[model samples]
Target: MAEPTGAAAPGFELPLLLFAGFRSIIDDLHRELAEQGHPEVRPAYGYALQAVGRDGATASEIGRRLGVSKQAAGKTVDRLERLGYVERADDPQDGRRKLVRLSPRGIDVLVRSAEGFDRLRAAWVRALGAERVAALESDLRTMASADAFRLDATSWFNG
Candidate 1:
């Protein structure tokens, strides 16, 4: 609803507050994930991991999904490999291409992440009550488009 006439205009705090809320949830998730032995995981790694998917993907494909250059995606893959989070294999369909697949460690981390998010959501339900939380999620869904639900959100948001 619009503010009444003569009311003060809104500043940037609304967006900032929304971002802060998101940052808080993500930060809490990461903290818990670190405690679970994924201290090396970074925020960016989640997007990269999602892009790699269960079927595996090439650096180029991951790059496309992540809205990053192939070189950048390859670097991320290299780091993930060193961290034991992913492994590269020769692509069966294309001899010249390599597919980046999540290793056991990667799969473990993702499983842990899902559990962590569920716990976090449950905590929110406890604090806000289930109906309010459900309404909040529904409202967010109403505001956000399916097209916005992409791993390439960096470019989507920036552009």
Candidate 2:
């Protein structure tokens, strides 16, 4: 028996490639976080911390920024709170909302992680040559900013 055309081959190879790379990066980050005494911390928590900002953010705002639901954002915040990486305080202007901010421990972890990222970035730059690396970054950013590619990208500052 012959197979049907559409069902004969699985498509979406390009999206699968993207998914593989994304998953690998997350895995690497988890390994690094484990080494830093934060085995429980996930990449989502780091992203949430970055989005929370200095003034802090409400769960709804975090959900919007992270492309998650408010309930999910609140759950993530709760996990971070248990990890001593974030804290929730009363939002002075709104009794219904609580402001989520990085705790001192969170800041320390973020700084350390950033330092590690910078070091790895420098290695990549050296391996690729500074000029080539710069050009590659620019090209990637341009592609990411294009209408056709922008929707596939997660953040404007992703590069």
Candidate 3:
């Protein structure tokens, strides 16, 4: 066996750092949900819930927004339906397609997740100062708006 050596490991990038931060926040939110007696919820499920908002949406739309396949989105919907978080109904405009919407229980989860995010934001503000946090938010928004880094996801909305 020969020892092969190549380039050194890459250093942390801004995207990776941001993703790590998001993961941490989501993990905290999941823990909070569990503490509040909602243990079936997961971070990925939140994305699906957001995609299927009050107006409801099709699995194909969700998959497009989430950067996943239609089958993957359908599976997420199925899991959520099994968990009593969402309901699927035939689309009025297209009987062949189905629209998914959050159930009352799913709404509760959404509310709790919003509260969790607020709590996390407050903690960050307390630790880093409001001005700094505001500046960071603005910078992140600017970065997101850049033409080179367009993100097309409905995860930001409380859907």
Candidate 4:
């Protein structure tokens, strides 16, 4: 039997390690959020919350921004409404359409979440030092905006 053969394994580089570190940090953030009070919240919920921020939006518009079907967007809106994080009403401009917006309670939740995130960020800066943290953020942003780093191999955001 011939022994399996392959090129010598390349040692882990800084970029690979940084990517792994980022993945771990993201997972930890989600876990922390769940432990804090949003155990039922999912990624889709975050996207919807972001969409419905002060501007308010319709399910169709949310779907367009999130790359989901209108039905999926509506379902997410329903879930958020049930959680008391969002409200839906007839669009003033078009009574036939509905618009969704964050409720006062939802605004409170968002504020608290921002505070918690600030604490988390501060801890990271204290641990990594402001300069290193700044450098890491700059590198991440550069990569995030690069076409090769995008989901469709283009860019992360439209604007």
Predicted model with the maximum TM-score: 1
lDDT of 2 by residue, 1-159 (tens): 233476644456645655665576567656877898878776666788887877899988887777677897788888889999889999999888789988998897788778767665677687889898788668768766445432112443343
- True-vs-predicted CA distance for residue 133, candidate 1, Å: 0.6
**Candidate 3 residue-wise lDDT, 8-89, digit = tens:** 4346455677787787888888999999979988777887888888799999988877777799789989999999999999
57-114 per-residue lDDT for model 1 (tens digits): 9999999999989998899999999999999999999999999999999999999989
Evaluate candidate 2 by giving its C-alpha RMSD to the native, one decimal. 7.4
Ranked by lDDT, top first:
1, 3, 2, 4
How does each model score on lDDT? 0.90, 0.74, 0.82, 0.71
Clashes of 1: 0
Instruction: Identify the candidate with maximal lDDT.
Output: 1
Error of 3 at 47 (Å): 0.7
| lDDT, model 3, position 34 | 96
- How well does model 2 score by local distance difference test? 0.74
- What is the alpha-carbon lDDT for the whole of candidate 4? 0.71
Candidate 3 TM-score, C-alpha based: 0.78
Q: Model 2, residue 69: displacement in angstroms? A: 1.6
What residue pairs clash in candidate 3, if any at all? none
Worst 10 residues of 4 by lDDT: 150-159
lDDT of 4 by residue, 63-85 (tens): 77666678977887899899888
